[model samples]
Target: MNYRTHIVSDLSEIGQAGWDGLVRAQDKPNPFLSYAFLHALHESGSAAPQTGWQPQYLVLFDGEELAAALPLYVKDHSYGEYVFDWAWADAYQRHGLDYYPKLLSAIPFTPVSGPRLMARDAHARAALVDVLVATQQATEVSSTHLLFPPEEQARQLKEAGFLLRSGVQFHWLNGGYANFEEFLATLEQKKRKNIRAERRKVAQAGVTLRRVRGREATHADWVLFNRCYRNTYRAHHSTPYLNLDFFERIGRDMPDNILLVIAEREGRPIAASLVIHDETTLYGRYWGELEHVPCLHFEAAYYQPLEFCIEQKIAVFEGGAQGEHKMARGFLPTRTWSAHWLAHPSFADAVERFLERESGGIDDYLDELNERTPFRK
Candidate 1:
């Protein structure tokens, strides 16, 4: 049994068909994994080496068919990865070791959990895992990390000698809600009242919200969304990881999977949120507002998308990254996983010990979060 390998710097190196075919074969395929979306990230220079995310896509072929593929990158910094490792990097830095240029497999800037290793079967996936380790060793990076991979892949990575780290994000699950009101009705009275109050605040503030599908989103709309996206980052005093070009590319290339919620005041768009969705799930990606309105963020980012989810029967809406506040808005805490492999023995042991303790803390945290569910019993 022989398998061919391709160290793809450009996604087109393996072609869209092969790459997407592998993604489709995976039990969970999302828009972010689709070739168009990833290619856009590369061609637009959003995730380029110059910007710290140098694409190092890995693939394996079995007699002219793609057996496995990993959306790998040589990351110089841990900026876009949602799974934070700044402490680990700092530990290495204090000890005079390089932590940059680490091997990473994740959708850059996107933290929604799903498959990172796209493979036809378990065998191919296992091979991909082995290849990932080989590539890490060959590259001589400090560590190899796969972020937001599903439990199964995380386990596979752990089985192959990787440290598993856990984090939590808020996700709203659909309950066959025929309407937004029906969904809200299931929540505790106080929670339901709070949601209505928030929505009413937006309404009273004369902030009208509209949802635009990507196909219907014009260049002007992209510009508006970009303005809001940048504003959000600026408010945080941080640089926006993605650019207007990346947004436009995805809007052009993967229109069906996009939803842009824009807030209007005096019939002028002031805020916008970008969300990615498939048949069953919606990912809350990015948002920004030019003018702040009370509850406008919730209206544009959370409530509007939840309405879309209810209407479309989308089962899950992942509010990206840490937002314990989301639980108040009906988004419950959910556990997210990342697997890591460190080359340095002492550092690896230290990280392993730390993760063991962290995992237990996460377990307790989840229990506490579950006890605080906003729904009526």
Candidate 2:
């Protein structure tokens, strides 16, 4: 099979229909990899060159048919990517080297693990790995990083000479429970009791919660969510990577895949959590509040979304990034994978040794987390 590669700066270069067709063909089709979600990231300027997420998407064409593509980015700074590489950048600076213009492959502002390489078949997938390595060598970049790829894809990256790095995220798996209560019943009594108490705290505070599907969400609802989203970032003394335009674009383009869990006081919205879902999984993305109700964050962000997952028969709910606290709420620690390739030989050797040590730490961490399982044994 003759394969051609095009390093595009825009999704319009390949168009939605073609790109989406390949995403759907993958063994695991996810909403984050969809054209609707990614195109919105760039088109809304949330993940564009201006913000340091310059698109360098690699598309493989087999005689005019879009065979596969990787959502690549040229990042000047690492703000939205949850994978911590600041130490690597600092090390480069200490050596009087530059690391700002590194290459990254990930969904902007989302830490959920899913497909990064949206390929139609093994042939194209293999071709993509080769093209990416060749592209890395030809470019004047410090490193190329692939964050939150599946375990299989990470292994393939390893065979292609990329170093594999492991991390952990909390996720809730369905046990075929008929409802929320039934699901809660599987947890240890202490955990179950604590969760009940937390939910009650929100209710006793006179906060009422409701969910709004994207199609049914009003502009006012989005405005409220953006406020809450920005507030969360502000509280941490940081700027939000996404804006209202980005949320509204995803809402407009992929309404069926979105759900907003909002909390109200006296029929007025005060807090909200945004989650994205498909038939298989629900990804907890963002959340914030105007007033601090005890445990309101868990209610809006975790409990409500967990209930929605059970009701919809969704197989998994990724609780997003790092949160050991999520374990008490019935989430279990799950392993996430990323691959890295440093351009400098000395730096590459150093990182490879560092990753070796980091990998061992992650193994012990997972074992410890398993020993403290929240579920009844």
lDDT value for model 2: 0.92
Best by lDDT: 2
Question: What's each prediction's TM-score?
Answer: 0.98, 0.98
Superpose all Cα atoms of candidate 1 onto the true structure and report the RMSD in Å to 1 decimal: 1.0
TM-score of 2: 0.98
Q: In candidate 2, what are the lDDT values of residues 1-377, reduced to their tens digit?
A: 88888999988888888988888888877898888999888888899999899999998999989988998999999899999999999999999999989999998888877787778888889988889999999999999999999999999999999999999999999998999999889999999999999998889899999999999998999999999999988999989888899899989999999999999999888899999999989999999888778899999999999999888999999999999999998889999999999999999999999999999999999999999999999
**Per-residue CA lDDT of candidate 1, range 325-356, in tens?**
89988889888999999999999999999999
Give all candidates' CA lDDT scores: 0.90, 0.92
Worst 10 residues of 2 by lDDT: 112-121
- In candidate 2, which residue pairs get closer than 3 Å at backbone N, Cα or C atoms, i.e. clash? none
Clash counts per candidate, in order, are: 0, 0
